[model samples]
Target: MIMPRKGGKEAHDEMHKANPNLKVIFMSGYTADAIHESFGLIARVPFLSKPFGPSSLARKVREVLDTQ
Candidate 1:
């Protein structure tokens, strides 16, 4: 589950609680202050800041997916 700040984090949180096995990869184009305002602590999730290159994006996705 990939949840950016644009969509409500509550939805993700609720879904996450229901299925704790889910691995959420969050992305954000907003600044730190904006991200804090938009979202609370994303429980058991990896956060990926935007403007990332292909290697970082691919590596992260692979790292998460490979573990599963």
Candidate 2:
């Protein structure tokens, strides 16, 4: 579940309740402080910032999934 840091807090919170076990990769170019303030701490996973290289992102995805 990849959700934007945009939209209101309600949208972000709703997603977790729907599927708490879902693996989410909250991608945001904004700083970590901004994301935490808006969405609260995600125990599932951290976020991916913008401008990340393709291979790095792919590797991350694979690593996350591989753990499952």
Candidate 3:
């Protein structure tokens, strides 16, 4: 579980500080737009909305990996 005081982005930031090449696919049960606005994430950032199936998960992973 993530710390209540620190969200995923904060945790990712800390991790990224250690390894700048880290790639992430943020996930949330909230709607993608809501998550993006609330989290201050860019539209093109890799994200996976909840309740996704295997194929969708695979596709998202591939998309993130394929991105520069």
Query: Model 2: per-residue lDDT, tens digit, 1-68?
Result: 23476463466568878977655566778766777776675545556778699987888788777765
Ranked candidates, highest TM-score first = 3, 2, 1
The lowest-lDDT stretch of 10 consecutive residues in candidate 1 is 1-10
Expressed as tens digits, the lDDT of each residue in 1-68 for candidate 3 is 14679887788779989998888888888887987888787898788888899999999999988877
Q: What's the distance in Å from true for residue 25, model 1?
A: 0.5
Quality of model 3 by C-alpha lDDT:
0.83
Clashing pairs in 1: none
Number of the top-ranking candidate, with lDDT as the measure: 3
lDDT of 1 by residue, 1-68 (tens): 23465364777668779998777667777654566556765344556778788999888888888776
TM-score of each: 0.59, 0.60, 0.84
Q: Which of 1 and 3 is the better model by TM-score?
A: 3
**Each model's backbone clash number:** 0, 0, 0
Task: List per-prediction Cα lDDT, in the order shown.
Answer: 0.68, 0.66, 0.83
Question: Tell me, what's the RMSD of every candidate?
Answer: 4.4, 4.0, 1.9
Clashes of 3: 0
